[model samples]
Target: MPTTQQAIPFHLAFPVHSLAAARSFYGELLGCPEGRSSADWVDFDFYGHQIVAHLAPEEAGHRQTSAVDGDAVPVRHFGAVLPMAQWQSLADKLRQADTRFIIEPHIRFKGEVGEQATMFFLDPSGNAVEFKAFADIGAMFAK
Candidate 1:
């Protein structure tokens, strides 16, 4: 729907220990809504992308974290930069759902370059997703 140039909406698969827990985390907690679900795998609409949670307990703890803005960000994370209005709506929805956040939603660089609302949270499968929004799209690449 005329997303950004780099936003064609891709598909991804991640490992999950429990399907039911993953479903609750993505479907209920994050409110991703459901797509296709099975005993070993489940598909979810992750911010307009297709994400499948495959049952793979062994791959659960194999992720590494990298330093980012003084936080240990997951090395294999994915998310999107939603519009400001959508960001606020999602923030309220997350609050209503009592979503546990890895990084609380807030402005990172207030009154500076790249100022935006950012938040990090993990699904039941331990996959990290960071949602960010830029009030001024031009500031996305400011220095």
Candidate 2:
């Protein structure tokens, strides 16, 4: 049985145009450590989760979006919830790197339930990725 104190790890597999680009984006830029790899796919330790990038150009990138909080949020995306400071640091790092943001780092739902600092950006293959943080973690899932 799983313990409440420890969240279970998750595995995600997504398509990428090129394995080299995935390595550079996920491994070098995002700092996700590389794991098992083969000619067609590569895995990264994405913040304690397993994320595999398979070589499939036609299946990559996010096309549709949904309106949310006055922003066009990608319809299909995945991300992690970091602590406040860590989120800030990553935001700063991405800024310094001149990464193009889908949604620039900002606090949403201010003074309301589930208020959080969040950002959205794309990987080299145009996969939308989001990173967010909550000042009060308990508010994360609150309505």
Candidate 3:
């Protein structure tokens, strides 16, 4: 069994086309609590981590991909690993909201690296975000 790492919350700052869009997506839709902000940027509580969205439409959105398990996984993206139920709930919520998925929610590496469910979608600014879960949390990092 693998041991969990000491959780030191991470901070990330990314580009967004619009602050209002980012707020609606990360705050209202995704349910990430908002934090400090200015005219140029806004911070969101991304599952205990700090992610600041800065106004930079030119820099927003992912453009490259790398193949992974037969999927064109976004080369640049960020997300969190959730519990199975939580992941499913969020997936349902997104679907109900009529979100356009980059990759629909589904199990990956099933029976190989344990049952892992994952999904990918874009924020209003076109920034890709992924949410996933592993049936066996301890095996998340299995090699």
Candidate 4:
């Protein structure tokens, strides 16, 4: 049997079109608690990780997508792997905020490997995030 690994927190920086809108989306809509901030950038505790929104118009315009299970999955996306309950809570919270989703939160691969609750949404800066969770941790990377 393999030992359970400890999940280390991380920090990520991504481009956004508007700092103010990004602030509201992450800090208010998504409910990520606020951290540090400046006129050009803002930080949030994104599911236990530090995610900074930087004002970069050039990077915000382009989006890359790929075909996955007949769905056009955003190629340039980042997200946290949360516990099932936490993931459900986030989905509920987003719905309550009237947040629009690129992909509705749903279970993928029912009764199969890598089955998870997944959803995609763009930040105010246009950066994409796909939050997901596996019911069985051991099957997180199953093929």
Q: TM-score, each model?
A: 0.80, 0.96, 0.95, 0.88
Per-residue C-alpha lDDT of model 3 across residues 1-143, encoded as one tens digit per residue = 33376787889999999999999999999999999999999999999999999999999999999987888889889999999999999999999999999999999887896668999998888888999999899888888
2 versus 3: better lDDT goes to: 2
How many clashes does the backbone of model 3 have? 0
Worst 10 residues of 1 by lDDT: 1-10
**Ten contiguous residues with the weakest lDDT in model 2:** 1-10
Q: Give the clashing pairs for model 1.
A: none
Clashes of each: 0, 0, 0, 2
Candidate 2 lDDT, 8-123, residue by residue in tens: 99999999999999999999999999999999999999999999999999999999999978889999999999999999999999999999998999998888899999999999
lDDT per residue (tens digit) for residues 44-103 in model 1: 998899999899988863378887666676787777788999898888888888888887
lDDT of 3 at 134: 92
lDDT of 4: 0.84
RMSD of 2: 1.5
Candidate 1 segments whose C-alpha is farther than 4 A from its true place: 1-7, 141-143
Better of 1 and 2 by TM-score: 2
Cα lDDT tens digits, model 4, 1-143, are 34458767788988888888887888777788989999888899998899988888888832789986656889999988889998999999889888788889988778877888899988766678899999897888778
